[model samples]
Target chain A: METQDLTIDDCWNRIGIWSRGTEKCPSLADVIHCRNCPVFAETGRRLLRTPPHEGYRREWTRILADEKETKPLNLTSVFVFRTGSEWLGLPAAMIREIVPMGPIHSLPNISSDSLRGLVNIHGRLHICVSIGSVLGIAKRTRNGEERDPAYSAPARLVVAVQENRPVAFPVTETRGIVHFTPEMVKELPVTVSGTKAAYTTGILQLGNLDIGLLKDKPLFKALTKDLK
Target chain B: MLLLLFEIGSDRYALDARQIVEVVPLVRLKLIPNTPDHIAGLMNYRGAAIPVIDLCRLLTAVPCENSFSTRIIIVKHQVENSGEVSLALMANNVTETVQTSLEALPPSGTIMAETLYGGVSGPDASELIQWFDVKKIIPEKDFLFPAGE
Candidate 1:
């Protein structure tokens, strides 16, 4: 039979790895992968742009028959922790790491309760600040063995970096990383006081509890200030 | 120098990769009647028709097997009277290229095919590769139908 008689415009299937019982195209080595080859890319474009056949409309109609599935992806990730009795949440991106609560070395002459002292964590000194005092949350200890069972996950210093300076704050208990959708976040209620509401972006609802989503910028600004 | 390597029958051969315009997959061509056995057909290369020479048919009587590795190596070489011509050299198992200068292949070797064959790489080399001069196999007078005519 004449070679012309067996002509095919799509040479890729005939020579490419896609073909059955055919050796892979020699050009594959130079191009490395099929995606890198112009011929392969051109073939894909031609496939999409080719004149529609009888089944073209039928194939597309069948594919488009079903409704698209929508999955509720958790868009916001935050580290939920408790400062005094108030549950606060910070965007996971802002908090660099969390370490076990250590002895805070009080800086001489600086007598602010908020700026507790410097804590040595992994040979690095981080300014340990009491988040409860910084936010002016009243010192009401949940005393006893049954003291906040859910939030009894020991205290840890949340290390966050601002302008290269690392600051560490104590959290009563960390809820680890929580993924929440937009629907779970509610606007700050009017009853939220000035000093407390100033740093919070929104209130995140988790089960029966409400978590104040702290605004990273304003909180960092407040922490860095009154240091000098 | 880089050389596009291919096997003709059992023996491996090479062509200067520098002369190679593009290594295209084997495609169907417009057949030309009364042409020499080595002359495969005219390939439509971007609207312009280019003549393709089947190196296997030229060397051996058998046509190249319809395998994926078998490809048309398009090259533009200087012709005698005509300045430059784009011709396709079809070969089998044209998988990869080798990086070695022609100087590496010593002149001392057996003469398989005189005019078309260039310097043969000595047995001392890792793999014996005979350099096929795409210039010599230009089908000067034998090519009855010149493409673009």
Candidate 2:
């Protein structure tokens, strides 16, 4: 039978009969079940045959092309992460690496709230900052019990750039990189929380939550502020 | 003239539909700090950035909430010196568009010509509509940019 003649319903019916056996066979005799039925087996084989219908392929290609065209261009890769209950999108190009939260040696006499100290990764020391303090988001402590970063389950280091210098900050969780189109961007309202309004370039509507797009300038400035 | 009616708290207001470009869902607007409280900041309309104002805050001192009926009414606002520019007016509980004429609207009787444009009987005869004076919403200097810069 031609692939064009086979519909999705027919394939589903074949699958249903194969699983239900002779008693459930609608078209074939009860005794001559799906096992012996040439129609059921042939239909299944025909469905599996390579070189699918040209019309179907063209329809799918057209649909995908329309989707891409409508989504707008300038495909930006972003590393999405969570810190202090806020979801932030950082451009992947600006991020050096996402490393496990390692031993950060606290610097003495450092007065900045965000700038914690330094962490030695692969023999090189990187400046570590607390993203919560930089963004003004209160850290969630259980019953005033401070969870150690070294042993925390969601702690990870985000090595990012600030004024041409490398700055690493801690995040609650890393959601990995997601490719976003210009269409996904919504203007960040001036009425947004006072904490993230300064640096958030735009808002990306991802699912039900708005992911604040953090640019290199603000993120770096916040991380490095008062340290100089 | 066709009028776009919307509500802010308990009051119903209208803007000439001819000046309205489009009505859109209230989306997050990028805040411009140091600007007046009325200036809600910038919003991405089409591909360009346009200033948005909180209509409720400007007129009634009520901050517009993010609700199901909240919307941004894009309209052409004519500034004193500068030519007409597109601006988004954020308002809450947009009701519907109704056709009415300026002559049909009764004078609001308020002597404040700068703010109160006019008044009209709403679609539902029970409600009184206060026409919004778009021109007086923001002064030229305080429109988009802050007081000095």
Question: How would the docking of model 1 be graded?
Answer: incorrect
Model 2 alpha-carbon miss at residue B83, Å? 41
Model 1 stretches with alpha carbons more than 4 Å out: A1-74, A140-154, B1-149
Say what the interface RMSD of candidate 2 is.
19.1
**Candidate 1 lDDT, tens digit per residue, A109-176?**
98666787899999988888777766777543547555554334437889987667789998877788
Tens digit of lDDT per residue, candidate 2, span A4-67? 4445545324444555443454645543555556555555544443333446544533442242
At residue B100, candidate 2 shows an lDDT of 69
Clashing residue pairs in candidate 1, if any?
A: none
Error of 2 at B35 (Å): 70
Runs of candidate 2 exceeding 4 Å displacement:
A1-71, A140-143, A146-154, B1-149
Model number with the top DockQ: 1
CA lDDT, every prediction?
0.72, 0.70
Deviation in Å, model 1, residue B129 alpha carbon: 24
* Candidate 2 residue pairs that clash: A188-B29, A188-B30, A189-B28, A189-B29, A189-B30, A190-B29, A190-B30, A190-B31
